[model samples]
Target: MSTIAPARVVLEAAGIRKQFPGVVALDDVSLRLRSGEIQALVGENGAGKSTLIKILTGVYQPDAGSVTIDGAPVRFGSARDALKAGISVVHQEHNLIPQFTVAENILLERIPTRLPQLVDYAAIYREARPWMKTVGLDMPATRSVSALSAAQMQLVEIAKALSLQARILLLDEPTAAITPHETGYLFRVLRELRAQGVAVVFVSHKLEEVFELADRVTVLRDGRNTALDHEIKGLTQDQMVTYMIGRSDVLAQLPARPARGEPVLEVRDLATEAGARGITFSLHRGEILGLYGLVGAGRTELAKAIIGELKVTGGDVLVRGRSARIRDLRDALARHRIGYVSENRKEEGLILLHSVLTNMSITIWRRLRLFGQWIRRSSETAAVMPLVKQLDVRAHSLAQQVGTLSGGNQQKVSLGKWLAADVEILIIDEPTIGIDIKTKNALHELIWNLAANGKAIMVISSDMPEIVRLADRILIMRNHRLVGDISNSHDYEEVSAAIMSRLS
Candidate 1:
């Protein structure tokens, strides 16, 4: 009987080491990607997954290592050089220009031109059609990318990569924002790419996706390789967790608590300008109320409406049984002692250009003021330092820019600012999105503890496992309205089924 031949290695990195100031990002890490295969690169945030990707994509040069493509040694001085070498990346953040058409974004690198350096619109659309079809993107080439959904935008990124004739494609946290149906579509596309002899590197915090998609896995821990290209068929999820965190238990079980005191915040028939209609909910003291939904299901909109970010056209908001009129986010925090930790930390949650001290203390700057106007630096430092230490923020110093920290640390800073504000009610949106498993567990524990200490927290998340684990009760929303409210028993299968049923 004849057997199929093993796939050949298309790309290899050996003895890769990278270091940043005050931290060794990677130490002697290596990865190999075979043609017609999907290789999963996973690790805790700050464990050097991003660093290695940057090295391979020529965004950052490795301190000591060698990269070879098809048995030929190569050094890329820039991202353009890597692209020329048939390597392309679709980052977690969408890289498409908002105002540009699909055709323009897909063929941006080498747009066809007419005389006098004019863009050839007809040629651009014609050239982009095949790549768009390859990725199952059926949108018109003339459509502006800003109008597309998150899933659609991702397909455009993939189409753009294909337009470059990339032999190897790297996707970073590709499904962190999409729904289950959308994720299945993405997996289908990746499988098709693998069949076409393309090498793919998939990076994600979600292990289930890694198991479902990747053929082999390379696990990283503490900036080093724990498992290098192990076949996925032979490994269990527990084993993968062990490889990642040196422990079998990925997340510690939070203790169940009896329902506490009367409602701390009550929303009655809340109608928002952002499409949330007739939303009514009561969050009691020390309760972790989960708001679960698919993308654009108004979970975030509900939170924004509650925090006064969205205009409440018709609603009665009661805080501690008293009617409250919160004018804006400042009013929500100062007058009502309610704080919001936004999911888009890079944009709304944090001032990335500023120091950690500045971002952490910004929420309480008014409270820290003395003499009716002047703020004391000593008082601010004293107040913010405890939160910094409590959150275990991994920064060299308070002066370090928030932009320089890892995804996990930046999130901690985002949460820390609210803790500094000493808010009684907190709305946390997508608390663990784009973070690693270990950091995710840490954040989950922190939220649980806050609720245990009599703080009302409304968590908005698309991750079912997270909502099930951390929430005492879940409120399901669909099509800008609440569909079901269920108490949690903490059984994944049971809770997930009920959650999905609500969506259906």
Candidate 2:
């Protein structure tokens, strides 16, 4: 008699289907993750990747279908319940409390206490040391989370997950905020975890990293599995790209940078109270100037100071060769014709529950008011539609909630608002973040088109290839100071080497 082999799958979602009023978020989607393997979950925004992950991690209950662990069906009523089932997640967003110590945050549920119910501070630190060491995260357990950088906070999240003694791990955009050096260390940790037979589900928009780390891949599109559990060997990135986007015609080539015109904006001795110091750069019309740096290098702080989000301790921001005093964001946008798209798009960029029409038109509302204190909805719709269409935002209608759209589409919506305002100088921070290859190409084309039209554009990105691909000139920032500048000739290798040299 022949015996059947037992299933090695550690975590799986079988035939998942989810619905939210008008949207079918997931339709018969299936994913299987085995022990000792890293399975990549990839798709365009709104392709149902997040929804499926939430189901596996117990954040959302699937309308239909079941989740299984080790061939045993399980129902998770809460995130805590999933944790108890040996599944843990490291979210893209930091979930730790700012006021709490790293150890307290990591061991919140299982803190050791004395007879008087007083927290055992010494034990708390010791409990977290092993997990932290596993990931090469060096930090005092007593340090406040607010004191840590974005990359350090991410490492804490990973350590916290490991503290749960999880066999199945889900990491969402884990490297989104980390530096390349830190990412290399993180990859080593993950490889070690895999060798120890831990199953991992990795989700990210950075295709290069996915290709480098994933042993197998799964592609989702429109809530269904288009490419389920595909092995990495013999599969080209081009083939995988086609699977997620569902078309080969999507533009991949970025246009050449337009000829540099006279300076549209100049920052002289720019210093912000938040730590950006002595930043000096002149952005010319028809030029896409990129700012590249590691996380917490004062890049975002510099942008904030220029746009008046952060109080400028000292500096002269000149517009068209003339000093323009930006009192606030409104002054920057309305008076100086400058606009900024923040890095934290979900929180600072859009009011998620609002409609797409509202999100795109919000910035231009001062102009949208027909009569005193009266705004015409039709006029608002008409004003933003052309730009929305230009960005190719996929939505059910103009009235559809912005939060319900895919990541790529939502980013377009965020960009659309600035376009609607018709700003002279636009600063976009990590525009293609969480965006697929096709959508990224479309965004690149739109960016170049704007610069080519004589609108000065400044792109701030942590991505080397992205900056190298798009920038005519790249500026490097380190420790709140301008360190180096390199003109791009589209030679990614040489440009990246030059960047690392300065950073090192």
Candidate 3:
């Protein structure tokens, strides 16, 4: 009576519904992924993208839904269950053990056993090299994953999925941490996987990549599909952004530059042992200085040197027209009233298991105490509530664990963590690395506001558009050296060429 589809149906979900205390994350969402199609899942922050993916991957069981793989209905109670059903998820953050070899990480649970039930290390090395080569990753199976960079680790995660016989692969923000060359490599792998009849659900906020790689793009807003089957062809980036946010007015709310005042920070011949050399810069009150470069271009190194995280080999730092000795981070904080928002949010910034209030209050603990021995919860709450409200941190309450928040919210916590400490000179590194478009604009507004209040801001980012939009003056760092400065020009090509010249 009915003809079945010839293509393999890798996964299907029906009426998925997920709820939290105050957030209905997913509401009756339905999706079907075919064997070889690259389906893109896109939305603004807190738009149920992560929740739906978690449901599919069995990280969280849907309160009301049914998942079917190869036409067989299944209830996946745990991640192990989902993996056993031929599904694998590679998170934005790598989940591999750093100390383990690539071969061990690839064959994490199902390592081939010898007759004595011991791990066959030699066999593992022999088996893993070809798989790594298949993905165009050139690394020995015996090498530790810790020694690899961020992009290399991502390749390892994909390789691990390939080892698991992943019929359906979930890539959550795969290109966020990679370089342009590595991004191309990843795109090639995605194409190869699609050709081999492996379904992929790619989640990312970078619309360019989404349209470039996906066949069909699904847009979700407030747990409902705006456009589930929108073809990528003939789709404008602005139109896609509008569909995700449900409004055309977001672009009009950009900040207007008023003025930039006198110099608040000055550095001369600043050099760090870790490749930062002969750097000289100045930041004025009510000014936002942008440092743009590739991943290892000494942008962050210069920030650390200025903030006293890295020792200055031979240089002088002046704050508000006075010679300052920033021997250590705390000393710099105490003497110069400086604050730094680290690039690595999870590892360097926030305590995941701690509540938002606790993370915000960690810096101002003594300020809220009556006798420096007892904490005043009310005072701490009062002090943190305004910042929480101002930053638009979404949660049931400030008591919610920050780890449970989205990437954008986590970044807000990182920024708020420093703002709560009352730092005048703020150094923000990669403020919107993995954030969505909506969140990125919100953060840009916040940074503009901070600069408008006469708080000197130093922004270091790899995103060229962000740097061009925010920087009053742009400094190009290459090979740990400040090559050129763009003070009066906002020309993208000129600035980009200046930074890229050093790589050549």
Global lDDT of model 1:
0.91
Q: Weakest 10 consecutive residues, lDDT, candidate 2?
A: 1-10
lDDT of 3 by residue, 113-136 (tens): 786778788888888887798677
Candidate 2 per-residue lDDT, tens place, 148-208, comes to 8777887788788888898898999888777787788888888888877788899988888
The C-alpha lDDT values of all candidates are 0.91, 0.87, 0.84
TM-score for each predicted model, relative to the true structure = 0.95, 0.87, 0.90
Model 3 lDDT at residue 468: 79
RMSD of 1: 2.3
Number of the predicted model whose lDDT against the real structure is largest: 1
> In model 1, where do residues sit more than 4 Å from their true spots?
1-5, 20-22, 114-116
What residue runs in model 3 are displaced by over 4 Å at the alpha carbon? 1-9, 20-23, 61-66, 70-78, 249-253, 488-504
TM-score of candidate 2 against the unseen true structure? 0.87
- Over all chains combined, what TM-score does candidate 1 have? 0.95
* lDDT assessment of candidate 3: 0.84
**Candidate 2 has which clashing residue pairs, if any?**
none
